[model samples]
Target: MLAFLVAGVILGVLARVLHHEPDDPSPVLTVVLGAVAAAAAGGVMNLFLGDDLTALTPWSFTSSCIVTFVLLGLLEGVWWRRP
Candidate 1:
């Protein structure tokens, strides 16, 4: 859980930096959403793998990253479509 939160924060910051645009919402919101997505993904992965919340595995980490990025992309799309 701790590792996931840390990784999620890092990924969230990365997403904010890499995909940010002038019309987008607050950077802090983007990062928060990314972290939430990552943590949720990590928790789901751990549940499936029968591991503890803090368990750190390659697959779990990879899934967390992937889910976070995907959610960030979706968020960007939604923001883009807004008038």
Candidate 2:
């Protein structure tokens, strides 16, 4: 869980840095989304890997980062479409 959150935060910051715009959402939301994405991805990975809940693995971290970035992209798209 801790590792997931940590990775999430880092990925969130990365997303924020990469998605720079004149009118973007708050960093808090991005960070929160990253955290949630990481946790959800981690859970899915645990189910498939048959590992303990808190266990951290390279695959889990990679998946978490990927999911987080994907989610951030979705979020930016949604914001782009919003009036």
Candidate 3:
């Protein structure tokens, strides 16, 4: 849990820093959001993986961040941006 929180904070900060004209949420909010995301990711895995792998692990944390970032980017239409 603590590891997940720490990882989430780090991920959120990096997301903010890399935002290119980024309007990031407040640091505290970012952490909270990341935590929520991490939990959701774990829940998804639990729902899907099913009796095979343990739900929340280092891989889960990493996957949670990747999924969060990708989803955020997708919603922002990164690929459709004008360069």
Candidate 4:
């Protein structure tokens, strides 16, 4: 959980930095949302993949990251579409 939260925050910060748009969401908000999304994704992955929740395996980490990135991208797209 701790590792996932850290990873989420890092990814969120990286995403925010890379975008650097005036209309983008706040950094804190992005990090919080990213952490939540990552935790949710980790839970789902553990449920479906039969992996231990507390174990930080490579596969689990990779899947969580992939899910987080995809989710963030979708969120950005939705925000972009809003008028």
Best by lDDT: 2
Tens digits of per-residue lDDT, candidate 1, 5-83, equal 7777888788778876788767888788878888889889988999987688888888998998888888877755577
- Model 4 spans with C-alpha error above 4 angstroms: none
Query: Lowest summed-lDDT stretch of 10 residues in model 4?
Result: 73-82
Q: Quick one: how many clashes does candidate 3 have? A: 0
Residue 32: error of model 3 in Å?
Answer: 1.6
For 1-83, candidate 4 gives per-residue lDDT tens digits of 77777788887887777776777777887788778777777767776788777567676677778878877776665765458
Cα deviation in Å at residue 28, candidate 3?
A: 2.4
The 10 consecutive residues of candidate 3 with the worst lDDT sum are 71-80
- Sorting all predicted structures by lDDT, with the top scorer first, yields 2, 1, 4, 3
In order, candidate lDDTs are 0.82, 0.84, 0.58, 0.75
Q: Which of 1 and 2 is the better model by TM-score?
A: 1
Q: Rank the candidates by TM-score, best first.
A: 1, 2, 4, 3
Q: State in Å the error of residue 23, model 1.
A: 1.3
Clashes of each: 0, 0, 0, 0
Give the winner by lDDT: 2 or 4. Answer: 2
Q: Candidate 3 — what's its lDDT? A: 0.58
**Candidate 4 vs. true structure, TM-score:** 0.84
Residue lDDT tens for model 2, 1-83? 88898888888898889887867778998899989899889878977898887778888878877888888888876755458
TM-score computed on alpha carbons, candidate 1: 0.87
Least well predicted 10-residue stretch by lDDT in candidate 1: 74-83
TM-scores of the models, in the order given: 0.87, 0.86, 0.57, 0.84
Superposition error at 13 for model 2 (Å): 1.0
